[model samples]
Target: MNGNGTLIHLDNIYTAYEGAAFPVIRGITLSIRAGEYAIVGGPNGAGKTTLLESMNGMLRLTHGSATVCGLDVRRQGCEVRKRVGYVVQSFFFDPLTPFTTEQVVMMGRYGLLGCLRRPGEADYAAVDRAIRLLGLEDLRDRPIGTLSGGQQQKALIAQNLAKEPEILLLDEPFSNLDLCTRDFVSGVLKDLAKKGIAVVMVSHAFDGLPDGEIRIIVMRDGTLSLDETCRPDEVESRVRKASTVQ
Candidate 1:
């Protein structure tokens, strides 16, 4: 709970997983404001994903404070999650899974609808807008599981958009996407940022970043090594310089 314009604020926080021996990240502090495009990069096991989860309130903090969208991450995790869209690192679906792309996207509205209530006109409108924004209109009725991995990834993003999140946390979202799709998705992210949606992404692929200033955060040994703003083209080099293993 700090900084009015800051969408995510973590102050001297320590996060650990269930039954873990010790904390994965410690004494962490960072602030991300709206309309910012941030790229988190580091060597493997450097707590990049952990930082994203911490911001999304998906992990338990053993110490310090984490606030997202003006709510306490520790005490108001559910509310925090509602305003933050988190696209995880890995996901796949069985080909026979029954839900269509549209149905899956509508699931984002479930949290807001509450118990025993169905999606109303406004909810459906939001879903439709999200689908169209992601260019998934052609795949709206297709079974989500039957789509290619890249298509499925795009659908996942559209699903999050349907929630109308103030901030988006994406972990290697382009891993399944090729160069062309990466460029298109990069444009989509840039547009979201321009519209005042904070985009925090963790990715090694840096060839398709947008043409603007990008905030680069680097992690090392579960600690923040660097935090700076540079041109989009400088992200990879800065990450390399800050990573411990490089």
Candidate 2:
């Protein structure tokens, strides 16, 4: 964490995709502290996912600056990624893929283990902890491709947990999950936040929000339109109102 306890700091940042005519997100400034639960919401083309990519240094900054985990995003993107975990909005694994759940989870440690080093006992322990945390113990040996969408989502989340990131950026994590599973995953995220891991998610579903105060950041036209702290029940309405306004 930084000296001020801010894990993510973006100052007037602008990010653009390759060969794009202009930046996808522009003049955006935001900060997130450790243990805070923040939701990013907006209409379909509001650049919510682009914001996540900018936070984790996945996209190049075209202007201004970004710092995550106390490292400069543009200058230290590779290092920044090591301490921040990102779960993308969509992924499809081929059914014929041969990796097991455990193996998939273990892959998260590869960044720390590097190319030549083997996974040590500590690595295995971390993988085990992640699997248990995600309630995937019974399915640890099953092929990842064979699991249901919700199960696969859990495994992917577990994989990121194995990395033990200080910040977790999830883009619509509840998309594949059913009602019960959404609640279950929300509880897990709540626990993670309580343990001091920053959770910033892009989501449309607000029914299963974790208890207590929450932060809502709404975007429109490639920039933040609304940002405030509110109750869980007020999130959807606030976002809806912000999104519909001219």
Candidate 3:
């Protein structure tokens, strides 16, 4: 821990999708500090994704509160999102989509550019850095939809990185990657953590995790059942046991 204080704070939050009568997640309380690597795990429909959405201000908090990067999530959603990078679990791009890989990555900086502001040299530099970080230089000119699944995933990650966010939230990041690709991506995330970027991932697969202590959070139904720090090797077992209702 870096003793830099909390980066994400959720105090008894309850969130629900619009038009849904019942909230999907409730009574959720958590605190995450800077430079921490956290994994959210549980069975299907375990509210894992909902928790991530709440943190990013995608879902409205029906009760309680949430703060990310010291900005109030409810009141400062636009500001929070500007600083938080989120990669969705699954996405499909139409084959004819006109955006090139570089263009898509540049979209990440759009929030910061704001209305009437164009991307300048510094923005281009950031995009180039992110593309190189994900090893996507060769594919930068290719249409995003034309790339393979693994390549597209890398592009998506690069896009988020272009924003220079303090926190990176990934949902099932390895879903489209193979064993070798998973290893590569894991190492990439680990390196980002070393640079003090908080990497919070929601995933089901436990293999190919980065080395070091990991913060494991297991959610069941709509509430957190376990939150603990453990060695990477113990994560699978701990999550498996904690996911079951006690």
Best by lDDT: 2
Model 3 regions more than 4 Å off:
1-3
TM-scores of all predicted structures: 0.96, 0.98, 0.97
lDDT per residue for candidate 2 within 84-181, as digits (tens), equals 98898999999988999999999989988889999999999999999999999999999999999999999999999999999999999999999999
Distance (Å) between predicted and true CA of 71, model 3?
A: 0.5
lDDT of each: 0.91, 0.93, 0.92
- TM-score top scorer: 2
**213 in model 2: Cα distance from truth in Å?**
1.5
Q: Which candidate model has the greater lDDT, 1 or 2?
A: 2
The TM-score of candidate 3 is 0.97
**Listing every candidate in turn, what is its Cα RMSD in Å to the true structure after a full C-alpha superposition?**
1.4, 0.9, 1.6
lDDT string for model 3 (114-178, tens) is 98989999999999999999999999999999999999999999999999999999999999998
Candidate 3, residue 97: Cα displacement in angstroms equals: 0.5
How well is each residue in 172-207 modelled by candidate 1, as lDDT tens digits?
A: 999999888888899899999999999999989888
Candidate 1 to truth, TM: 0.96
CA RMSD (A), model 1: 1.4
